[model samples]
Target: MGIFRFSDMPLKKKITLIAVVSSSVSLLMACLVFILSESLTFPRVMRQNLSNLAQIIGDNSTAALSFNDSRTAQGLLDTLKANPHILSACLYDLKGQVFARYARPDAPQYWPAVVWEEKSEFSGGSVRIFQPVLSGGDRVGTLYLESDTREMQLRMMDYTLVTVVVGVLAFLISLLVASRLQQRVTGPLQQVVDRMKDIAKGEGDLTKRLEVTGKDEIGEVAEAFNTFVGKLQGVEDMKLDLISVVSHQLKTPVAEINGFIENMMMGLTGELNPKQKTYLDEMRAIGRENYRLITDLLSASKIDRGVVTVDLKPVSTKEVVGLAIRDYEVPLARKGLSLELEGVWEGGMLYADRDKLVEALRNLINNAIKCTDKGSITVRALTEGDMGVIEVADTGIGMDAETMGRLFTKNRVLGKEAHRSGAGLGLYITKNFMKQQNGDITVTSEKGRGTCFKLAVPRFKPGEGGRL
Candidate 1:
């Protein structure tokens, strides 16, 4: 129903198709030229051959015609039997009357009764010629000859058969050679495409490269690709170093600033007015947020450098949830959002890193509070099979499918409206933290409804080598 466009073909097929089509067209043209040349040249050669035979007979028949020896003229005419293409022969007197005649058994009986002129022509698939008899440089009579074009026709057929056979063999050879040679071009291109796919799928192994085997265009392309990826790798390293340095340099000052604000509120300086106290409080909050951002950056840098470690041990999920909630109690009241803890801990102890579990809980609760405006937040902890599951559900502005897909991806900020002050690294770090402890985190959300985050940690059992 529709044309198959050339662009839609794969690289290898495109190359092979080009080679095969080029060879086929060239072969076709060559065959056509050969056939056409033979078609024209073969007829001329046949006419020349017949004329030579007619000339010899006319020269020898002069004596017979001048002396009125019809018998000798008949002998000259009968000599035409040597050539199978000569269908009939005749001798005409000076008055243009037929003097002698000869015809092959299969030739037609009808012929011109008299010679018309000294000329040769082709008509009705046959050649006819009228030549003048000459003796002593004087024209005496005429010699008429007629020939079938069967010999030339047969030669043309033979040429056609040979051309067809040769064309087919050449086509096969060209196809075979092209199919093998095209790999030299498409092979490198295919390798580049595969590496690109691997990078696009987040494998991100920039160290991998195409093997350069020549100094041609393909090799140049491979060199360019390798250089580009190397530059990207360098940029990534520089970014990580910058983040690590800036965060480390800022974390201490922010913590000290928050300490000084706390001391001022406790009247380490002169007692402050209400306005001064409110300003100090605001300063403390801002300092604490700055400190949190620095901590997240440091943790992310450590994760990137593969230096983050988890101290796995038996821990109570209930204690971890209680600790995480206490940190958010002030923010929850400020926002007038309800906080409900539905965790009844009758389950087995979790085999996880206690600090990492608490940090993960705090990140989830913080995100829930940030997204939610008026609705309540619920924390549910329970045991299923050999795992302890914590569910943090919030009546907040949830995400669409497009945002949800990259929710835990590093360096991807979801939406500016949803996370106005977030660095987009909290969930990424938390997910990695859970993974380090042999646990996992999952999420579910609807665009307009709400979001639910689930964190699963393995249950601890005695005599199990302290491993999940």
Candidate 2:
């Protein structure tokens, strides 16, 4: 048999078990104390009472015994008839003859024969008390008292039974009360645990507060949790405010700069020398990257606000690919990398937000331009079952496993150039756009070999322009 471990049980069982065990132990202690006291004191009390009874009988029977009056001596010994514990009584003359005697009607069946002795003994649940009768300091006769102790033993057994019954009752009552009170402690803690789970699972609504019931440890825990949530809410609000201001304010000047550069490059301002135009070309590229960063931040803010809207329409696959290629033509040319298009589905179409698809392709093209050093960047498109797959492969310093794992997360810009110029939010925003259009993006890369990005889009069906 194995002993049960208390800690493995639930809290409610622990409380109830503790209460029952404690009450039983306390009751058992009380019962043991009562038994011990009774055992030690009861025998002495019974012996003293027997001794006093013998003395009184001897004192009264002195005259009857000295004169040898059998009737008076019998009457004197008969006084013990009222006490049920006194089984038998005898008055003996100095010659050791039992001159007179009195025996209880309910006395033991076998009694010791009256021996001629001045000594008493205890045997067979009774005590034999032998006391000498004296008259004027002279021994006259002896009084013998035999007391039955069975009644006292039965009384102690009854007391023990009552003690056991009371102990059981106390244990039950204590268990019930402790179980009810234990809920007061575990109930609030359970509520707190539930609320924390809700916050963790759903949209983190830090504004939710707990009900403070009383000034106890549970209340203190609730107060502390509420305080922690308030602090987190403050931090989230501050982060959003800062991002909003920077996204809106910083984009204006950078857009203006791009606008002026375009005007100058198109000969709207003035003609430029080769060196001046080259420097202006570099500046234009930097400005364009900066503008793209700001736009990514603004898009992230919109996503956080749950305002992602996609205006879907039927678009030619060639048109989408053409726009992305033309948008990144300068970066590809600057890096001396050729663009190759393979398996372009000519007649196939897509039902998606045209701008989102083109923008996502543009980010992929820019990423390809950043990583490739030698081989051509290949663009492939084909209809595969119900979806259209657009793949962009780059022969560049590809990403390792760790970089690929966090590639689509915010603030995870990989390359040195990307870290300096990019806000690390492009792929994050692009991923969301793909998801919003019911499409997906995946990547396959190796550290030193190459990398490829695949964008899957829902193919356009008949009578499905924006909704299907």
Candidate 3:
């Protein structure tokens, strides 16, 4: 078993522990103060009381001392029996000689001959007090009192008991209050976290809100989250609506242009000259690029609206790769760029929307073509684990750290030239399409080296999609 340290403790447990420790420390300090005050003040108070009693005794015994009567002096000192704290008492003459002494009846008479001291003090858990006896307003004798401190011990014990009770009560009360306080602070934050997770997991509902319990910091956090999500929802909605309208409008023109170019290439109206045919082919390429862009934009709009219609079917990885090569071969050949085919996709059956996956593959290829200028591009498809992986690698001008970091961010393209010439939505749309179809895309690149984009989708099993 691993040892549990305070750093590894969970939040609520940490909260509870802090409260308990604080209460314990406060109680411990109070206990120390009480003990210290008693240690000093208790002895002083006992000494003062003993000194007063001894003075009264000496005053009453003044005549006895003057008449040289031991019996009367002893009787005056014996009155100390009334105080349980007074262990023993002694009467002395003006010459400082012991005249009489008294002790508790049951207590051993351990009285020793004493000399006069100028101070009242505590020793051996007891206090000694001394007073002067007088006759005819002249110093006649001195009387001394010894206190046992048993009564003081009893009183201190009672004080200690009360302090312990209060400390325990304080600790228990703090735990309850602290637990409640911790709940109040963490509750709304937890709700915000759960709600954000729900949206990320595809619920995507921005209307849900955290209840505002107060106008404190926690409530402010909830309010900030709601406002931020509201803004994000607005932006996303506007983006999709604009894309849908623009793409739909552009699709018609691209279709018409492609139709006219195909007709000219097919010689539907009349035979064309060689130079005219070549220019028509170039126009066809341009038309195809436009058509593909419009299609991607429309698909992205559908995807953003969460209204994408996916038709997952068994499709061979080789066939998909072939389609991608066919799409890019003309452009690559024009640029004198070589396209290499690598490792066969043996367990080739993959479940995906054939058109959508093809579009994603094409974007990766096109993106590579944009970044890479001279070197060959490599296309590889292979089965790894439970997924089929398609890799499009380019040996061209690689990307910098900043470009790579924001590569798939919405409306952020890799290169400034590409941003000016093209909409910066290809990689972002490609990633979204892959995610909606339960796939993933990853990119690895190094500056001045090359870039590789990988698309991993689940391999199809027999009858995986049933009918649809």
Candidate 4:
């Protein structure tokens, strides 16, 4: 889990982390190899040097040992004092008796009682070497030399100190280099992310393209993204064309038909029987619903095409709400639902577009009436913080969490039953209209309880020119 999370880290951080870890591991391995090589090589070199010195001494003392002269042999042994690590030296005759010996002033005279064959052994921080004495290809005596191992210990100490210093410097250099170089890779990635965010926020500038620096992977990605956005722009153009046809070719005819139906119901045409009246009534109702759908689709398309403009000014919340509620009075009365106006007088002027505010409120009220079977609808308005708030609450069949999650999305149906009715653009349009006017809408609902939709707009300040 930890590895996966680290792998998911931002590209810049991941690059730096990889550089630092790789440098550190490489440095560690190199240091280990250096120490191991020095350890093995140092002992062999020390043993060879000691053996050469012993061979020279044995050759110099061959005549002295053959004539049994201790002074000459002792003089030859005294040369060992020149090397500080050589603590002591001894010569043993063929009879295994000590013939002549030399010891450093501070070191003890330590030797075996009998001389053995030519060999070397290291023990207790010292090395002892027994080299054979030869004359005319015959073994004469054994020269034993004991030396302290402090030189190898000091050499190792120096190597360790140098390794630590080099490791620290290397690590710092690697970190600095990695940090500087990682920007080449991460900078382009960050640009792509920022551009994607702008597009997602509905800036809708699909003409924007990423600059490609080279024929690298990042460059490839930028090119691919540009291609994708271009295709999307083409699709959006087609959608706008379709909306244009619907506006010019469809809406006018539908409105004329609805008007004719209304005229017939009002007796502008010939009178009708009971069955005919009922049929005409149902047709009018269906015609009204179809007209609403056409208008909603047009509004949604305008919002998407970024052509919807707001004439921002100071608007009276009470007046707007009254005007919007006037259209829904008959629906409320038909449903036998009560209406309550609370805090309406206290609703301060807001910086908004009057028409947009009315449209948003009407949509919310219409939804409330459709969802509600009994109880009442309440419209409230007041000031909160720097914004004026208007709330439309209804005793309706409220939504669950899952339904509310996608409620304001375009063409998202409200419930299983809603799939048979509505283009699902009501809340989506209302929300977008509020946003264009620098206002916002939110809702709160509980299943089987009720729902409340809140519209917030900037409070009107006289000197601010009604700008949000």
Most accurate candidate by lDDT: 4
Residue pairs with clashing backbones, model 2: none
Write the number of the candidate with greater TM-score, choosing between 3 and 4.
Answer: 4
Candidate with top TM-score is: 1
Q: Count clashing residue pairs per candidate.
A: 0, 0, 0, 0
Candidate 4 at residue 118, lDDT?
80
**TM-score-better candidate, 1 vs 4:** 1
Q: Mind giving the per-residue lDDT tens digits that candidate 2 earns over 174-216?
A: 8889889889978888888888898886545677798888889
Q: Could you give candidate 4's per-residue lDDT for residues 175-199 as a string of tens digits?
A: 8999998999999988888998999
Worst 10 residues of 2 by lDDT: 108-117
C-alpha TM-score for every candidate: 0.77, 0.63, 0.60, 0.71
Residue 294 in candidate 3, Cα distance off native in Å: 3.3
Model 4 local distance difference test score = 0.87
lDDT of 1 by residue, 138-235 (tens): 87888778999988888888988998898888888877888798888888888888888888887668767778878998889889989998998788
Candidate 1 vs. true structure, TM-score: 0.77
Q: Estimate every model's Cα lDDT from 0 to 1.
A: 0.86, 0.82, 0.80, 0.87
Candidate 3 lDDT tens digits, 142-216:
777888888789989888888889888988889989889888777777787788788787555776677877898
CA shift of 24, model 4, Å: 6.9
